[model samples]
Target: MTNLYRAGDLRTPDALAKVTPEQAGWTYSGMEVFDLAAAESVTRVLDGIEGVLVPLSATDVTVTVDGDRHRLRGRVGVFDAVSDWIYLPLGSTVEISGASGEVALCSSRAEVRHEVAVVAAEDVPVEVRGSGRATRQVTNIATPSSFEGADKINVCEVITPGGNVSSWPPHRHDGIGDCEPVNEEIYYFRMGQDDSSHGHPNGLGMFRVYTVDGSSDETCPIFDGDVYLIPEGYHGPSIALPEYPMYFLNVLAGPLPERTMAFCDDPAHHRIREEWTDEDQDPRLPMTSAESRVS
Candidate 1:
């Protein structure tokens, strides 16, 4: 295994400032690619644009500023099938997308490995409307007992398996807490098949992002290979219509004095929380054994 720790140390202000998207050859799509040095600087620029990084192949990029390091990785392509890991120094902001393989984000000193499986739970919190889809949670690190003293990152995957995860009453993350400030997040989507072995995969799911002043409705159109980012504001309960079971990969980072999520519920259906019931796990879940590889 290659030790990628050195790549993380080179993303200083001066080095990053000297690079540009053009010189780095960061194309929207193509065989065009960058090595570790160029990839690091390119990630900085992408970070500035909140860049939507498309993976040309399974790739890795690491950036370190001063003593802090941040690393980003792409899913290893199906054929090569090699697991990749990047290390970020403590406090470096890192975002990862297009990862079908296992991943991790941690303080540089922490010995976190790629297969560690950082997601918190299999069955997550969900709120549903009468006819819409369900907001099933895949991972969460903020449970009561886990909230030791300081808040950790909040990462979850929302599945619209049958187009039922969206279109309820829209919701946001503002004022959800008193002890810690709100965090920023990313949404990565995995589009469902047109014809599931079970059913169809199409229904217009809506997501809106907004602030107290106003909101942007239907800003994110759900589709395969697209990623929507939440720098701040209300996101949604994605509703999958009759077709389209949308799966969302969510990543959140915030500064919380304590490790708990106090979300600002959507007032429209906040009352629904009172009547919710925990459904038994769908036997179809865990889709297949984790060790099983796609042939």
Candidate 2:
């Protein structure tokens, strides 16, 4: 069974009144959930599963820990600007400090930004793959940073440029297996391809989610600006339409008493792992040092 909540579900009456026009204009259509019965303490595990936080405007933030404060300044881009969207991770405890501006955070375990980058969108390289065309933009955040060690969270941007991300070979990661316990994930989508100089949005893609105890379902057609959730299960190469590419942002987290994704590969595409290599990024990532500084 599907065990996730969309951004719409997390809104409290108090939260709605607090949103501004510009901030309210952005869509909060993704998933958020939590897993409390694992080996670790609930607080540690729940830290990252707080859900995705989407900001509506630029504002100043102050996060206080034991009286020492860390500040964060939020800024949103203008319409038609190179980067149409911006994002911040979840579990970020920012206090409004005092800006007549408004910022909205989701109840998800982590935070995610769209197209907000350290460089200009034009400078970011674009890579054309079997799936479609993708513009890779590097993000600088401190929380769940990469895919190496088990930590508070993991975040990434995946652009299906030429085709679909065929996350084939179904798989699952429960505390019993390689992944840590109570791990949750979020997928925030950009638009799928339209057949032009690019490609066309094709067949239905799916997220086959299941737990080790044997429960699952295939998620429906995931399109642009859509957000999906995976509290636990084998997710995949996002299916790309034969014509165009589909894109998404993936954010993962869990109270890794052990902080790791130690799991058995779905035997089907298991061999696919052997073909992988840590080469330089495929040449198409967008954004360059000069372009990013345009602001």
Candidate 3:
């Protein structure tokens, strides 16, 4: 029944973190985070799943799908810039190798196969959302509008500056309202300290998830490398601490016939959207971009 997993709690010998739909008690959506050593390699076969290979902290990574090689010019860290990624189709053999640092394999169950393609960091869409303290940077890696190859999986990265909040107004995509799309979501967090691009273990943040009827409610502190699963609920307000910036990678999937990120906001706080019109967005936003990663 626990939804939050701390760093190292899900570690395996080959991966720093790993989660599968079966392990999460859901039908779709899964992810694995691996810390690779120089010249080392890992291989996986996507039997009935489609996935995206995202480099977390290295620019020299290489991904090979069914014999086709893709060199990814990734960033130094999630806070440093947007990363190059690869889309993997169902029933293909994937091999990840080359330089070091962390890489995330985000996946979802799929029935239809899509073509494999490499997406450069510059090609990813960057959007600054909200206003004032509610501001955050959203890097759309594989959202429905941004990418059309996938049948189920959806992935994105969010960066919240120090003392700010992201994922506000608490929304739900569990088909609770008319036309709401249902999806299982996973949040993989990374917290920054001082001037470091690589996240720190001691850095902290907060997150909350609850039902509208008050049947279930949970709020807790979040740390670097932590993972939170949302099977069903209105979730939001990922708060970054005063001195520690926050970053989270989101992977989502579900049984819906069409892939979508549509959601219904919590009515009580929905009015906050109107308030953002008069407020100025924090200047620290657009924290990371493809141009910023260049040395």
Candidate 4:
């Protein structure tokens, strides 16, 4: 019944973390984080799922999908820069091999099969959201607006600089209010030590999630590799401790006839958006970009 999962609680020999819809008691979203050694490879059969392969810390990654191979120019860490990603359609065979570091396989169940597509880091859209302390960088790797190749899967990464917050106003995509889309979402987190260039496992952050009826409320400290599931609720204010930047990969999916990221903000805090108009965006914004990853 808990929404938060610590890194230590979900470790396997080859994976740093793994979650399936069946495991989370949800219907749409799932993900696995692989920690690969040099020359190591991992294979999986996508029975009824579509997925995006994103490198968390591994730059020398090669993904072979249904006999076609694609190499990714991945960044050193999530905070370092945008990463190249590959999309695998449903009902295919996938093999991922790379030098030492981590990679994430973010997936969603799909009824329709789509074509395989490879996205370079430069092609990924980077956006800055919010203002002042709420400002954060969003790496749109496989969102609905960013990529049209997937049938149901939606993926993105967020970088909340040190001493700031992201995912504000506590929004929910549970199809309530005027919100038309309902989605199950997963947050896979990593923390950076002092700045964007230094990602450390020991860095710390915080996260909060709750329901409107006050049924479930959680505010907990987050560390590298922590995972949070948002089946249905208002979630927000992913807080990065002072001097420790926070990064998270978001994987989302739902049963809607079409894919969308529409969400309804909690009415109580909806007025916060107006306040941001008077504040200037943090200068530290746009923490990472494709050009920064260039070797």
Best by TM-score: 3
Candidate 1 Cα deviation (angstroms), residue 160: 2.0
lDDT of 4 by residue, 29-132 (tens): 99999887733799999999999999888878889998998898887788788889999999999999987788999999999899999898889999999999
lDDT of each: 0.36, 0.37, 0.90, 0.88
Q: For candidate 1, what is the lDDT?
A: 0.36
**Which residue pairs show backbone clashes in model 3?**
none
User: Could you tell me how far off, in angstroms, the CA of residue 210 lies in candidate 2 after the best superposition?
Assistant: 3.5
On residues 183-258, what C-alpha lDDT tens digit does candidate 3 reach at each position? Answer: 9999999999855687997799999999766898999999999999998888998999998999999999999899
CA deviation > 4 Å runs, candidate 2: 4-151, 166-171, 177-182, 192-205, 242-244, 261-263, 276-295
The sequence of per-residue lDDT tens digits that candidate 1 reaches over residues 42-73 is: 32212211111222133454334333444444
lDDT accuracy of residue 40 in candidate 3: 90
Work out the TM-score per prediction: 0.49, 0.50, 0.97, 0.96
Superposed by TM-score, candidate 4 places the C-alpha of residue 38 at a distance from the truth, in angstroms, of 7.8
The reply for model 1, stretches above 4 Å from the true place, is 1-132, 135-137, 141-152, 166-169, 176-181, 194-205, 278-295
- Against the true structure, what is every candidate's RMSD? 11.6, 10.9, 1.6, 1.8
Best by the lDDT measure: 3
**Per-residue lDDT value at 69 in model 3:** 87
